[model samples]
Target: MPETKKFLYVNRKAPYGTIYAQEALEVVLIGAAFEQDVSLAFLDDGVYQITKGQNTKEVSMKNFSLTYKALGDYDVNKIYVEQESLDARGLTLDDLLPLAWEDEDDDWAKKDSIKVVSAAEMAKIMEQSDIVFSF
Candidate 1:
């Protein structure tokens, strides 16, 4: 029997003022519901999804940043981001949500398998996935 496609959803937008982040999170939640091996890659402005301590109230938007924190509850922990993208925006992993796996061991930096890819390297990761969706 053919294998179920290993799914990947790539987000390339910022969290606020756009629905891409919310929509991508929805896909992650839904995919986890089905017990699929789902991984999410944040690129470009999408890294903002994991940016720490966002306050949406100023704009009257609900705190959607909290929604990202819930990904662990849904077992959507394979979160990845582009290193260069984060650097371009002057963000580091320290400025964003820590890996959920680190919660169990407190060795997040060691266990962090979040792929930090360049634009060229990102293409290779995309080629590796059986199914890839972009937003």
Candidate 2:
């Protein structure tokens, strides 16, 4: 069997007004489908991608934020949100979508997938990744 490598998808853009966030989401799902060890890092304006109550009606765009909830199903559970980025945007954990995964090994218990970490911690995570995709 091929050795599984840690794949980190780093998001650094806003959720809307561009294609970066959407493209990153698609790539993450594709990577996860390949059974790679996938992790996600949200920093800078990227934190907005997972924020709760997104309304893209006026912009005539589809609101894909809720799509993040499906990541857990793909086993892409390591979602790291930068604390500094949230603070800068005056947002809290409560302001983001509640993402969780079902642990089959633990009797299918639901567990949270989001981990809010400091910028330093996020950097360490990036460094530890065998392959990092930034958007």
TM-scores of the models, in the order given: 0.81, 0.96
lDDT of 1 by residue, 20-117 (tens): 78877777777787777778888898888878888877798777677776777666677778888998999887888765533455643344545566
List, residue by residue over 51-92, the lDDT tens digit for candidate 2: 988988899988889889999999988999999999999999
| Per-residue lDDT value at 61 in model 1 | 76
Deviating ranges (above 4 Å) for candidate 1: 102-115
| Candidate 1 TM-score, true structure as reference | 0.81
Ten-residue region with minimum lDDT total, candidate 2: 28-37
Give the Å shift of residue 101 in candidate 1. 3.4
Number of the top-ranking candidate, with TM-score as the measure: 2
